[model samples]
Target: MSLDIGDALRSGIDDLTGEDGLLVGSVFLLYSLGSLVADESLSAELLTLVFESGAYTAEQRAMVDSFGGSPFALGVGLPAAVVLVVLVALAGELVRYWAIRSFAGPAETETDAFGDRAVMAVGLGGAVALTTLLFQSVLPVVGQLGGVATTLVGSIVGPLAGLVLLTVFVYLRQEIALNDGGYGETVRNSFARFMDDPASIVILLVVLGLFGLVGGLPSLVAGLAGGDAAVAGLPVTVLTRLLSTVLGAVFQTLGIAVVTDAYLQVRTSARESAA
Candidate 1:
């Protein structure tokens, strides 16, 4: 039997409820909030440095310095900020492993596998981070070296390539969580799985992307209206950030559940065919 995209979506919705759903949701919430704090803290530090450099006029310096006093400003060193971000990312991946296992079914979701899974999650997360950094770092350089024509092409191709990589890594995470394979094997299998049914994966990705865009509208509007400005006694930017964080967490959980269910269906079909 081929994959039924609608059925997979329905299954995902079902998986994203009850105790397991709450567990996943909570972890994602913390993960998103941690990320937000880390990002704002780093931004604050950068702004403070720029203001103190004496490049800006006194008025500009004073304005930026005032922002340095905001609650998000941590005065953390770059090394410490990076470590905090890495820790948050690892925590996110750990919960992702648990969510995938739970969605896969009870037999695959073994309590004793925590230690092994944590190690695997670290490997998987690191690989993904490296892959993303490589693409980001390399693509811009490649574009620069080639001149305006190449830069234009890169502008279009870069995002498409990034999306494809994102899809592949999402499957890679599923593979790692569901199987007891080494890093290399998991990576190969994820690519192979995508090759087997790229259309479905792309379709699912588009659907999820649309959902994310819709969910982010409130934040977008808030930013456009005035990100730094206050609205009715509340900080619009902070409020929007919190709203976006919550919405992002919910959508991320749903997306993972959907992908996990879809992967299971494909794997089951492949097994039956082989049998």
Candidate 2:
């Protein structure tokens, strides 16, 4: 498959320009909200509650507390995290949509919502679930290896897990397209070609890495500033989590968009090759 970096970037821009901003915004809002609950800042409280309520033993709580994240993140912090995520997603989508549109034309209005959501759920959800599972299984070994060793293992394992997840995601997405009156086998075939063409996969990963970098910079900067400071109460903890969620949701969307577009591009390319 031929690589066209310029085209991809331009297409992502066009896709965003053509999107129903209101719809996208609404989705972002919901995503941001959900993310708030998922973030570490807010989740700590929930986890604490669970631990305090006897859901887990004191030893488990100790392990969790030992991880040493921001304790100041509570209620407000959580919302900030949510907004951060939403904003990042907004930025990522702005570029991604344009890039996609440059190549694919306007996304189909009739199928847009369902198609997007389906891809998001399957692609993102699958990756997260798989990664979490793998991470959990590896934790024992990681702990035995110590912090440095665990971190090293995580560095290698995370990307490998992503590759596996993407492969599974492509297959499922193709099935959706084919049977759901969606995009059809185009995605499936393209994914196969991308897999065969290592360069294309490398380019895709590079693009995704760029996206991650863009999405991560703000939070990293915040953490550096004062985000790491500890808060005194549950309310603050909840806020912090909310903020983390919003930020996570936004960045997560970027990831979701990249996966979706790549799958679609692969499908399109495969069809052209077949033709």
lDDT of 1 by residue, 101-189 (tens): 87777674434565766787777766675456335433543454455686666656776676667877667878877877777888887
For candidate 2, the per-residue lDDT at 252 reads 45
lDDT string for model 2 (31-140, tens) is: 55643434444444334444555644678656555444444345555356545444443443333333233323345222344344355435433444445534543333
Q: Give every collision pair in model 1.
A: none
RMSD of each: 5.0, 8.5
- Winner by lDDT: 1
Relative to the true structure, candidate 1 reaches a TM of 0.79
Local distance difference test scores for all models: 0.70, 0.46
